[model samples]
Target: MYLLTLSESKPPNIVFIVADDLGWNDVGYHNPEIKTPNIDKLAREGVILNQSYVQPLCSPSRSSFMSGYYPFRTGLQHLVIISFQPVCLPLNISTLPQELKKLGYATHMIGKWHLGFCKWECTPTYRGFDSFFGYYNADEDYYNHSLSRVPFKGYFLDYRDDRQPVRDQDGVYSTHAFTKRAESVISQHDTSKPLFLYLPYQAVHEPIEVPKQYENMYPNIQSEGRRKFSGMVSALDEGIGNVTAALKQKGIYDDTIILFTADNGGWVSYYGNNYPLRGGKFTIYEGGTRGAAFIRGTGITGNRTYDELIHAVDWLPTLVSAAGGSVTGRDGQDLWKSISTGSGENRTEFIYNIDDDFPPVEGHAGIRYYFFIFFIIPMLPVLMGDYKLIEGYPGLFPDWYKPDTEMSSLDDPVEEFMAREGYKADNGYQLFNIKEDPTEHNDLSTKNPEIVAKLKARLEYYRKTFYVKPNFPILPDFAADPTKFNNTWSPGWC
Candidate 1:
């Protein structure tokens, strides 16, 4: 029973802006220090879901967002750059934008595409976006704009029209360029056709650099790195303002649904913080998974705050439902209605786990300072709000909080923990009643025996059911074996 009831009405446009490595408290709404008036306006005018989440890392969170599936189910459990291995997302699964494209929406992705590197199968165009203009690597020099390859150089801006390569000018800062592209896409959209703009900004991520204008705005911040990072965030905020203004100028403001959130929590140690919340980016702690988020447009009213539990995986189904499309097979539920009435009978809590790269491999020993060097290390999975279990090495690097430790163990499995394919490590668990303590400050495993028993049983079931095998494959356009194509550098970022 496919309903076309909205044929008489115009379909709403959608613009989803996701920031990378942005902290929960980084936005003006949360962080008092940062001056992000533009993003803050979005929060003020829209509903801010105080309890929204995503996977702790970039690729996994991105996979969950685009495909409406848990990262593990997509075989994207580990980060992509492992042993030059290409981990492809299963092609059969339909992505959110792909589904919307079927419903007559023009899709465009600007800026960071960390989902897959050179793998063909996972390219945004192959995954259902109508157009893509961005970098392929996880992180690129914000200023140089070149990709690593000579042909691509530091300034590789891939502009694709339905998968066919188009020309993108060289030498544009990633943050401003993404906004400019987004504005161009929005302005060019035919009023008759609905548009879906997917802008994932690389701003606020690493190699932090900001235009001097915004850099000078945060002169008060003492640390040089933190000040520069703040400037980058300000620039990103300004970019958001530009996109918002463009949407308004096109007269599509009321009929469009706009979403703003992060790919993961801020890299707290690197001048990012999700303060009052523990853990960050790589870990499954609240600070890692929890982030600032909001949705405004079409059916949403102003200034409402939804405090229910929602994950990145839920956005697809929820947005689909809002767009008058049918919600299909997925682990997510349409949260809009639930948040509206607060009476929907949906699953309450979910799990967040970052699995060890199948065969535990070692990482590089780079000479960069604590800020850039230490990030290469993979962290153990900390199941947020669940039976606070320590999977791999427990307290292996007690001094991990510090920046300048030697090249060390992100590889060795903590001997005490369990190590089985589909089961949890043999380590004991630490439970927390997250509703009472969002920080996981107090361990409740010993005090609340019954709750501990309940969550542990739940964890066992989840590990068996979802964490079976991860999805990994190259995009369809790339050669069968990526390395063989000397011209892999010919397209996108090689």
Candidate 2:
């Protein structure tokens, strides 16, 4: 795994870039209409992960990345750590940053930190980041850096420079701000220490706002939401380009490892296009969990696609191994060798998510979730040797959503598209041959009953042994109200 720089005797700098809620087909390499030239070049030059997998939600996938454990294990298998949720990536677990830092890596973080931020200890600085410049929540203002779920209720300022909230970031778009910070980190680094910059960009999530120039770049896109979403993607791509330029300028580009991936599938409700892959974000389907991932490091072979399975949980051990450290009891396997030389079993199976959260076993029989209905749906999906099994809550958005083409004529097409009602699983317990049908279109459960039973048994065993219930008190913590902290979602609320 370390063969790339093992001879040089210098640990390569690691830059793990995570995109928030980017769909499988959003990238230019996946979809030509999305003009992400920089990303396309990176994918073309890097080893594109053709079968990369992650959790179906923001916090769950991020928790997997940070903790090297599934959400069920961390009790974060439920919904995301909301602006008011009193949770953080359990403190006992050693995070990826902490592990790398223990091995003398200079760790830094920028952009979204939706893992948890209830107390000062749960914030990034306390979670082992040498320096953290970002917010603690999601869907904040692209410009003003505030989160406003209710129009007139008031906006919570969430942006921060380290632990102190930065009000001056009001005018700066997050993509630009984070990009500059990353460049500055590279430019100003001691160089004596290998840097680990975990930049989880806030683009392409929600509040899909971007500068007019970016919007102008996608003038051909008919739907306003899709155009804006594409623009946001471009903005993020530009930021990445800038960061890479900074790395090269600092003379560490060749000695750096850039791992780029989306946290989860796109939210079709917010104009995300997953194309042929069935189901959007918040689903167990391939479109929701199979991310667009690529790695361009010093040793990875370029112009190649790795079809082997790699999960979000693998990053912790893989990176720690690359940083010349040992991690014990992690659910992740070191892929440094497989990624570096393409000559190893890069994880044959992974739990897409063992969500022991909500979604009772009624299994798609009750009301559908997301539309504010308490739908009983399948929640868990595990992949073992190309066969995927979903135990409950198959998905919120149930089919392939291509807003760019499917309903391009509509000005704002979210409601109308859902109104059209694509498709859903007839029975809750669903199975698919992910190897052949990457889109979860064909259910092989009836024909392959043994496979389904085996996978279901695995889920039951997981539930019995390791599952930590995502039991949030049915009420939002009123004490977490932003008004208490001068109208900002700062730590120490809980």
Candidate 3:
């Protein structure tokens, strides 16, 4: 029922950001050799979003953007929830900073809280984030912030300030201490309340450490891990140009909405590059769930390029319905009038990779409705509308285009590129119109066997009524329950 219209006496100021494994042509508006001029000036004032979509990893794309649901409905689909695990992100869900701190807004959160802290009510300031500094686990060490994994047997550290335990943030450089705590939380916000922040940024993830003055601004990047990952994406694009000049020096730059995405894609063994879109990060292909997005301040409207089809659980009901608030029973789709009138495409994405073990499911799943896109793990594909039915061979690292010294003896490049490209599941799929073959290299599933049996019966009816199970808690084997390691239960621990 929302068709866009807001300005309940000015409510803007959101900021968001994200960016961990970041790639899909590593910024500078999709690579001009990655300088990322402040995310290419927020993709030239903002809009871009060529096709968005996420959740190929990183705590299931941050638990589908803090629970607008769908990381297999919040069990956090599969990989990444590591350090101290007793599981999390289910304190009876309802986040997105507890619906923008119940609309009075000011809900902070600086950087990388790999979505679970084990206890203290699963951290992020007890889950609604009135403030949270950073690092809860999953990758740290940018100047000994610790955690290179030694989970319960000691050495964790993981830097924090809001929840304390901050050993004077050792040699800084966690993307310049999370962009100087997001420009000191936008220079001590409070301007009549209306600020969300949520930076994220564990820059170009990995121990690829930067700061040698951003590795002397990439000396002609000859690959020392892609010039330390283009100097950690040019120090996270100059800390997002000092957080958009601290929101235009706190006059709240055009009221401020911002966004900029990425939680997945780009990790071709860490020199990360989703070039010409294929497979990367943990593979759902289309370069690991098509990320590299955008949004930009206020009512949006800037250098355009929408292409609809958004996701990452539609930015928590499209920034809580662009701050006027109220987006009830949300599974994210407020998309603020299809991203401010760039026209419609509504939204229909399933995209999966389930496997915390529940119904003999192994990994990779898909759906996308209008303009079709079915898929199924053992290289199935599907796609429709711009055709694509593929049945194997999409490179989830078949020497992912080799050349990193032949990827160290090709250690299982998607099982030797599916047995040197023979991929047989009774050899049946291979169509491709990906709008004139966006590089699946033409096949046409044997000239459309009735659109591959009608997109494989709509991906088997969304895998039997929306793929179930996995409601959190699974990383147990703590060597036969060493008293289940700690945080057994929280959230008003009865």
Candidate 4:
């Protein structure tokens, strides 16, 4: 049972901000090397979530947050959707914005819409949001707002306003543009009705380009990637500050709930770092899944970090409940009351991800990078209470380390790590007492047979009940080329 009582007659406006590929230790509050004053201020003044977990990859974590179900339930457990894939988020689930609009909310979505847009029906505007402004894919050129990568080899524009291609934002930096759009939404909003704004950023991801001014802020850092990353984070922080100021200027700061989180762990190989947490993105490790997050505003008791376990799936129910809506059927538990009470007991178990073994299907979606092949391990991890069970290959990402010092480094460019003898056991299980071994130093699968067996049984049940197979859909040869439509990706051939 959950208890949340709001004093104001008007329902609270909910604003959720997500930073793509931001690491656990990349924030100023978490690591002193990073410069994020706005994010740090929010985290310091609000409740810091020390144990917030999300899926290891981009689309999976995003889909979970949007669908109120695990990636395994959405068929996004394997990998991200490429430009050529005909699938989007399953057309079945009633999205978060849809639920909010039922209570008379004006829902708006700004910045990255990586959930899925191959079909116009799956676009945020079509799905639920009254207004949508952003791109439909990942790793787009930050300045030109274009995506030119493998599978779709030319600079195809993915930025959009509702369904039409956005051709005007050619030279504008994506972060600044999205920030202005968000502020505009807040300023023009009808105050009498509640508003739900979802702003997912495109900062600090690959093609790690930030304006020279942001990179100039980090002169002392020697690594170019880390330097640019710090600057990108600064830009993101400043934009967040701008959004918060807009909320305050609208005279709704007290009645608005502002949440900030990275979609998943940092891309350590590039400009991300999840230091002090084992491994980086794509591994079923703590660094890959645990998020740096906080919730500030109405009903929040401020200035503290609530130390406990929470999952990305929980946000749907928690935010819906915070807005005075009922979430009767979802794979998530509302945690607002538990957070307010400092009980930290609303959740003690959650499955990190349920990944299927590689089947080597043609035209699978994967970032064409050295780290992508080295680090992307397909597996399952089920966390139950103090002991957590991992049933997959643990890639060789760097261990937790102090900042400014050289990172032990992300992943070794060799097959030895993935080919280690004990990497995948006979039964494919390894146990770690997360409460005790937070960095996951020791393996207890051999020692604690009963715990391993219990978690395995739980995984078996979840695997059987999954909504779809974890493997990504194979791209068909007849998929339409974006180049034919004047180099703009659209809901074509769907």
For this target, which candidate reaches the highest lDDT against the unseen true structure? 2
Q: How do the candidates rank by lDDT, highest first?
A: 2, 4, 3, 1
Angstrom error at residue 417, model 4: 9.4
**Candidate 1: stretches off by over 4 Å:** 1-8, 81-83, 117-119, 147-170, 340-346, 354-426, 470-494
Tens digits of per-residue lDDT for model 4 on 105-192?
Answer: 9999999888776668889998899998999989888989887655667788888888788998889999999999999999999998
Tell me the lDDT of candidate 1.
0.66
Model 1, span 184-217: residue lDDT tens: 9988988888888889998888766777888799
- lDDT to native, each model: 0.66, 0.79, 0.69, 0.77
Candidate 2 weakest lDDT stretch, 10 residues: 362-371
- Under the 3 Å rule for N, CA and C atoms, how many clashes does model 2 have? 9
RMSD of each: 10.0, 7.2, 21.8, 7.7
Model 4 spans > 4 angstroms off: 1-5, 359-385, 395-427, 476-478
lDDT by residue for model 2 over 272-312, one digit each (tens)? 87878988777777777789999887766667888777888
- Which residue pairs in candidate 2 collide? 1-337, 279-399, 367-375, 377-392, 377-393, 378-392, 378-393, 379-392, 379-393
Backbone Cα, N, C clashes tallied per candidate: 25, 9, 3, 0
Deviation in Å, model 1, residue 395 alpha carbon: 9.6
**In model 4, which range of ten residues has the least summed lDDT?**
362-371
